[model samples]
Target: MKTELDYLAELAGHGRISRRAFLGRAAALGVSAAMMPALAGKAFAQTAVKGGIIKAGLQGGESTNSLDPALNLSQVTFSFGKLWGEYL
Candidate 1:
């Protein structure tokens, strides 16, 4: 079920409500003033990406570190393996 905040968020997300109106309604619903901006920003943010390649660089890996989990030694290698490896 949707609450007042959820409805407000939806309205804010879809640009159906102005920021001032959203904040006013949210304030009436007892939301903190400090949290209003964050809530509004989250609602206004773009949707997540459907699919994409993710690239990352870590500094702790060494030439001797193996990508194999069983042979992993450094934290960077473990993190790299976790990023590329799939598990059930």
Candidate 2:
């Protein structure tokens, strides 16, 4: 017997949906997640800025920012988030 949740899942069409549909469902949950940061962000107290600042010396690579986080040395590739930051 299919549970109510199962029926809902089927209505989403045989358990397969387009990226747009998946994103729609995700967007609903995303709104709540997004709101929590916006609404509750102020309830938490703020701390004073510490004196230290981080400085990375860019001896190599272009100054341009690449959205591909997985960029590596000597080849072109599709990149997504990874264990290490981007490289040449």
Candidate 3:
């Protein structure tokens, strides 16, 4: 059985609740303000996912896009150039 504190902690971990709100609710539930940090830490702990392909759809791209950094006029070209170390 899950307690209210556990529910609040899970909500905080998943970003469903703000830090301030979580702290407030925990306090209302008689949790010590000082202990809030430790509880909050547990609530916020997360394991990073190992691998996945991330995709984003950005507007402002054109068929006439140029690879040259200097000629980058659209957001897509600019982002692509920056990611491939073109700006460096």
Assess every candidate by TM-score: 0.43, 0.24, 0.44
lDDT per residue (tens digit) for residues 48-74 in model 3: 665555364768778888779899877
lDDT of each: 0.78, 0.40, 0.77
Off by over 4 Å in 3: 42-88
lDDT score for candidate 3 against the true structure: 0.77
Candidate 2: lDDT over CA atoms?
A: 0.40
When summed lDDT is taken over every stretch of 10 residues in candidate 2, the lowest stretch is 74-83
Task: Name the TM-score of candidate 2.
Answer: 0.24
- On a 0 to 100 scale, what is the lDDT of residue 1 in model 1? 21
- The TM-score that candidate 1 achieves is 0.43
Give the total clashing residue pairs for model 3: 0
Say which candidate scores most in TM-score. 3
Question: Looking at candidate 1, what is the lDDT of residue 2?
Answer: 34
Candidate 1 residue spans exceeding 4 A from truth: 42-88
Using lDDT as the measure, the top candidate is 1
